[model samples]
Target: MTLRLGYGTNGLTDLRLDDALGLLADLGYDGVGLTLDHMHLDPLAPDLGARTRQVARRLAGLGLGVTVETGARYVLDPRRKHGPSLLDPDPDGRAARTALLVRAVEVAADLGAHAVHCFSGITPPDTAPDTAWQRLTGALAPVLEAADRAGVPLAVEPEPGHLLSALADFHHLRTLLGDPEPLGLTLDIGHCQCLEPASPADCVKEAGPWLRHVQIEDMRRGVHEHLPFGDGEIDFPPVLEALASTGYDGLTVVELPRHSHAGPELARTSLDFLRRAAATTNGAAPC
Candidate 1:
């Protein structure tokens, strides 16, 4: 079993999109988590279809795979980070977020990405839990249908402090959607360590069947910060072993959206750390 490594473009916000992809390729990353934002690929850019095709060509030339990420911080609302999400109170807001996700699925299809990563944003304090759940499911119906037709999986991530904040929440969502074939889980290792009752490794085992995408980073228990490999309390070797045991063929992507200042160097170090962890835990190196 081989576990490919990738890095998120959100961590390379300082670099131009082309430069970031080139840097990741040069650093031996197997894939990239392409987050659509105004500064990056800009999902709303004019002639986006042609641009997506061009990006596909670039990735093909570099021998790198991709997973379309829709968690761009300010893409939806410049005034607020990750605003107007699936759980938004207003119908129009929910529709806008859904529209963006649909576009992301289309881009993922064009790029041949294994999945499209997204999350239900924070629920308003005044909104009832049941109402928020209903909003999320209703918004996702069209997005899931789009993904199904495009032959791409919609990997919904469990975000801390969001409407869906844990593996159980994701399961609940899947259940509500009648377990749509195109719906899958974007299992973030850091999130598991921080918010889950189980260890990151255990969470991987639990999420194995529906895990279509993964985000990896070092994180402390109860904290939502994304840290470098050695800075956090997570024991990565065991986690790597668990993922390997699951026969997961997708990329374990490093996602440090806040560390773009040192993206090139950080990307190199992150890959080395993952390789060493895999070697130590599994007795063989990860490819």
Candidate 2:
């Protein structure tokens, strides 16, 4: 009854991609949340298929699973952070983002990744709520089609301050998309702690059926910041128990994108913390 834990590569920006993967493998992590970025696999790079094949081999050799993450801050737009979102007012801007996500689905298939993680970006200013919803639904349609074709689940995350900021918003999206099979949820534990009315453990239980990917970190209520273990108000043991009970087989990835300066050290310590927490959970041992 253990959860397979992994770490996100976005937190290891300072290390080479090879070194980062090797480091996680050596640390006994079961998988990785691989963010497609300029430094790590570079989704837009030339010969992307060859690069993806090489990474597939690396993960296979290391016995590590993967989930392709599409939250690279500047992969598409150099000047804007997470710009050209699904809800962008400009049609071309939204298409660019959709194309990137489609490419991500291809990469995920090649890597044999568990899922492809994404988010509906922040709602554009001066936009009506209904219009924003229309833009998002329109934008994600092709990406979902790509996921269906690739046999990969698209795990859309509910990011704080974004268009889809909560669990209800995700349900709204599901309803809008007509409950597509390839559509699934990436539930962030910290997000629950930060904004959800229910406890994080309860959120896990409620989201179980739709869960495809899970990102975890310690965070205080009402704050969106991602914190290391023991630095926030989350009670992790119950959350782990709930997660294990859900029968979700995907990686519960440690997401610390801003902690790359100390990525290796945090990777080691974070695993230790999760293992200890899992040990306390009703015999749900962590690997």
Candidate 3:
């Protein structure tokens, strides 16, 4: 079994998009986790189609794969990070969130990305759980259709403090989504370490069928902060081994969103650490 390694551009927010991709390719990474944000391939930018095509060419020339991501900190609302989410009380706000996701799907298709990762936002203080669930499902309707039409997967991640914060929450969403093949899971190994009842490896095993994308980082149990490998408590070898055992062919991306201050250094470090971890599992180098 093999796993391709990539790094998230959100972590490289300081670099130009081309420079970020070039740096990752030069580091021998197999792909990129491309985050759509105001500064990097903004989904709301005019001439987005042309920009996407250009990005596709650059990636092809670099011999790198990509996965689209929609977790930009303040893309939707400049003042509030991740505001106007799918569960927003106002119908227009929910519609806008859905539109952003649909645009993500369109970009994924254009870039030949394997998946588009997104999340359920925090539930509004005044909303009931059932109402939040309904709102989420309704908002996803068009996004799902766009994903299905584009032949790209919509991989919903379970964020630590968001509305859907666990593997079980993803399961519930799958049920609500009618288990569409294009609707899948973006399994963040660090998130499992932080909040899951099961070990990260076990979570990988259980999410095998639905897993479409992956994000990797290290974190202490019950702590939501993303940490560098040795600084955290996760036993990575077994977790990586479990992903390989499941025949997951997509990129297992390094997602250090807060490490952009030292982006280049951290990117190099992560690849080396992940390579050693993968070597422990298979006695061979990972891509």
Candidate 4:
């Protein structure tokens, strides 16, 4: 029951994409959470298919798996962080976000990624709850279709301060979309500690079936900041134990998008921390 660990490329923003991948590989990580940002893969860049193919080859050479992530704050609109979300009232605004997810599906398929990660944005102040739900479902439908065609799961994360920001909200979304096969969950361990009524381990156990991707970090019970392992309050041993118990085989990526200044050091220490945690779980494989 090895809980494979990887680091998010968003945290390695200071390095070139190739250099980031190489560093993770050299550190003995199993994979990477490759965010499609302007500095990285750039989903909106020209000759994207060619670029994706090149990245795919690089990943294969490095023996590192990948999960495509669409969480770049300003990729879609430079002025607005995470702008033009799926629940936007304007049709075109919603379409832009949907298109990005669809493109993510294509990239995921090309890269043989286990899942494509994304999130529901903050609800507009003027939007009604029902209307926002409607917009979210409508916008995600086509992206789900594209994922279905590409044979890639669209792993929607429950982001704090966003419209769909809880495990229950993820269930509601699954039901709303009629439980499409390609739709899955990106369970973030820190987010559970931040806001969930259940403990993070319990949340991992419960989300086992729908979970296709995962993000890990340390955080306090109420605050939303992503912190290094020992800096926060999460009891990681039980969390890793529950993750292994669930038989989830996807990469549980280290998510530290703001710590690029120490990305290389964090990446190394994070792998060591998680390896030690995994070792504490019975029948766990060694690093």
Candidate 5:
């Protein structure tokens, strides 16, 4: 299977969706990790069917595949950054979060996207650990059900400072959910490096069976900054080799929102880097 290369719209947050697609196409990406938000195609907006069709047609024109991501800050709470989480104190607030994710799943179904990238929000500051997990799983059940009905996979991403912070945490989450088919992992390589002692390559191998989506970015050993290619401590060659060995036929999204101003340049550089890395691993000449 070919490795699918894509970029996150988080990096192109300033550009219109059409322009972002055109720029990504021109830069030679095969897919996009479209982060659903207000400025871009707001998945919560009215006339979602028409909007989905429009986006699908545009992506088709560009020959781009998509994976929907739901990490938009403040989408649920205007006054808080990632507030009203799935584990919120208020039951109504948690339901609101679930409804938002259900909406995202419907949008993903409409676009024929491969999967939806989701995350467990930060635990409320004062809640007990057991209570937090209970609330989180309880909040996630409805979204998982909706995704099952829509025939879409939900990839739960482990973030640096969130409720689910590592592969081990993800394993715990999977066990808590009691069903692996509807819930899978979105392995963000940078986060793994920051939070775990294992190398990114080793993490990929360890999490091989559970990985449904992947994100790549450079980061230092103990920090979570999403750096551009070659700017951090990650050894891309071995990481690519590990992915190749797994025969993972999924999107490897380049997520560097900080470099959004250099979107075109970053996209070109990242794609070229991946091509060369893959070619070297396969004993083929780089383009």
Candidate 6:
């Protein structure tokens, strides 16, 4: 399977959507991890249908695949970053988050995206773990149904510091969902390095069957920083090899939102780095 390289809009936060798409296309990216944010797609914008159609047309013209990412802070709550999440104390807040994700599922369907990436939000203070899990699953249930109806996969990302923070958590989510077919994993390599006991490659290998999407970035061991290619301790070649071994054909998005100004260059460099690493690991090129 051909490994697809995509860039996340997080890294292009400063650029307008049109400019971001242009940069991604020019940089040889095959797709885009379109973060649903106010500055970018503006999911809360009126006339979402029209905007979705417009984006679909533009991406088609550019021959770029799309993946909806719903990790935008403050989209649902202006006062707090990622607040009123699935595990929020209030039921209305949980419903609001679910509604947003359902809209995202519709957008992904309209864009013909392979999947939409979501996450388990942080549990509030003094919340019981079981209660948090129940709340998160309850909130996600309708969203997953909407995704199934829209013919899009709902890929949950296991993030550091979030309710679901590792491969085991992901497995638990899948099991909780009764192993639903459309439910899958969006494995963020850097997060795995930061949170999982296994190496990123091992994590991917273990979660191979459920893996549907991927996010790649370098990060120091035990830290949550999203670093550039060589800045962190990750051994990316084996990670890529594991993905290849699993026959993962989904987009492997490069996410480094903190380096917006340097996004284009970083995207190009990261793609080149991954290609060279894959070649070396596959024995097609010398290290």
Clashing pairs in 6: none
Q: Cα miss at 152, model 4 (Å)?
A: 0.5
Candidate 5: residue 278 Cα off by (Å): 1.8
Scanning candidate 3 in windows of ten residues, the lowest lDDT window is: 278-287
Candidate with the larger lDDT of 2 and 6 = 2
The whole-model lDDT of each prediction reads 0.92, 0.96, 0.93, 0.94, 0.86, 0.88
Tens-digit per-residue lDDT, 190-212, candidate 3: 99999999999999999999999
lDDT digits (tens) for residues 1-287 of candidate 2: 77799999999999998899999999999999999999989988998999999999999999999999999999999999998899999999999999999999999999999899999999998999999999999999999999999999999999999989999999999999899999999999999999999999999999999999999999999999999999999999999999988999899999999999999999999999999999899846788
State the lDDT of candidate 4 residue by residue for 59-114, as single tens digits: 99999999999999999999999998998878999999999999999999999999
Backbone Cα, N, C clashes tallied per candidate = 0, 0, 0, 0, 0, 0
lDDT of model 4 at position 28: 97
- Candidate 4 residue pairs that clash: none
TM-score each candidate. Answer: 0.98, 0.99, 0.98, 0.99, 0.96, 0.96
**Colliding pairs, model 5:** none
Give candidate 2 regions above 4 Å deviation: none
On residues 236-263, what C-alpha lDDT tens digit does candidate 6 reach at each position?
A: 8888888888887888899897899988
Instruction: Tell me each candidate's RMSD, in Å, in order.
Output: 1.0, 0.7, 1.0, 0.8, 1.7, 1.9
> For model 5, how does the per-residue alpha-carbon lDDT over 1-287 read when each residue is reduced to its tens digit?
46788999989887899999999888888899999888788877887789889999999999998999988876777898777788899999998888888999999998988899988888888999899899989989989998899999999999988888899899998888896588988999998778887999899988888787899988888888999888888877777778767767778899997888888788888888878877766522232
Worst 10 residues of 5 by lDDT: 278-287
Cα lDDT for residue 287, candidate 3? 65
TM-score of 6: 0.96
